[model samples]
Target: MITPTSDRGTKQVHDGQDFVEFTRTFRAPAEDVWAAVTDPGRLARWIGSWRGDPADGEVWFRMLFEGDEIPEEHMAIHQCDAPHRLRVTSTSPSEEGPQVWDFRIDLVEANGVTTLTFAQSVPDAQLAEGVGPGWQYYLDRLMLAETGADPADIDFDDYYPALKEHYRELFA
Candidate 1:
């Protein structure tokens, strides 16, 4: 479950595109934090794992922590600047049809601390209700993973529904 101390994301517009953004800080260096997000092995500890060479600008990502029937998402890397920024687009099967998602991750180091900013473009506020908390859960899990703690200790139930209204209000 998420504690009151856990931070929530904000809604913003960049170039007229709606996005939900979250920020996380790590005592580690920028390169270390960057590897935690980009490296397939490190990612598997928190969010998910990926296959295929990133140099190919594409990879099949699987969300290991989600559920049993984990589907591989086709992620296309749009831009990659090591230890700083990464932009990617992913296509996943949705109830309506194939859903395309745009995600961005940026990292900056100051005073030996790395600040990681993550953003995902959303089509509407309704979607952000769920997406916001979902990312919060994963990002929190990432924190645990980075500290060598079990990410599974964080529950999704504490995020959704409970924090849904907070995110929905961002649009209002």
Candidate 2:
């Protein structure tokens, strides 16, 4: 069971055609959250296991979603600010040609609350649909992991399929 936190945030779908844009809010400070996302040590606690620095023009390693057993290809950091924004370019392997996935993250603070907005442009509709809940799961975990809590307690299997269907219904 997923117990929603008092500091919980929402994710909104911004575009449906060729990409998916998501915006979520967090209760932590921008700097702390940014470090949690950009720092390899901190990021491994929540998101997929990664390697290499998060500096601009750098390529990093990203493992698959299921576990760290299978390592994916490199993801290049296109642009980044210390605690404000980041842009990256990655390729997702598939039956067809690898699809390019461009991601942009913006950290905004208002009245002591920080909002992290993630915008992604995928090359295919199927990929965009799949990424919706996958991000939701990680972002929620990111929030919990930042607070010294274990985020692996929640089950994401059900939510992931449902989110993909929801995206299809909404965008179709």
| Best-fitting candidate, scored by lDDT | 1
What candidate 1 gets wrong by more than 4 Å, as runs, is 1-5
**TM-score for all predictions?**
0.95, 0.80
lDDT of each: 0.88, 0.67
lDDT of 1 by residue, 51-167 (tens): 999999999999998787867899999999998999999999877998888999999999999999999988887988998988988999999889888887878888878998888
Residue pairs in candidate 1 whose N, alpha carbon or C atoms collide under 3 angstroms: none
Candidate 2 on 25-85: residue-level lDDT in tens?
Answer: 6777899778877777787787765666555475655643576555475688877886898
User: What shift in Å separates residue 126 of candidate 1 from its native position after superposition?
Assistant: 1.3
Question: Candidate 1: worst 10 consecutive residues by lDDT?
Answer: 1-10
Q: Candidate 2, TM-score vs. the true structure?
A: 0.80
Candidate 2 ranges beyond 4 A from true positions:
3-17, 53-56
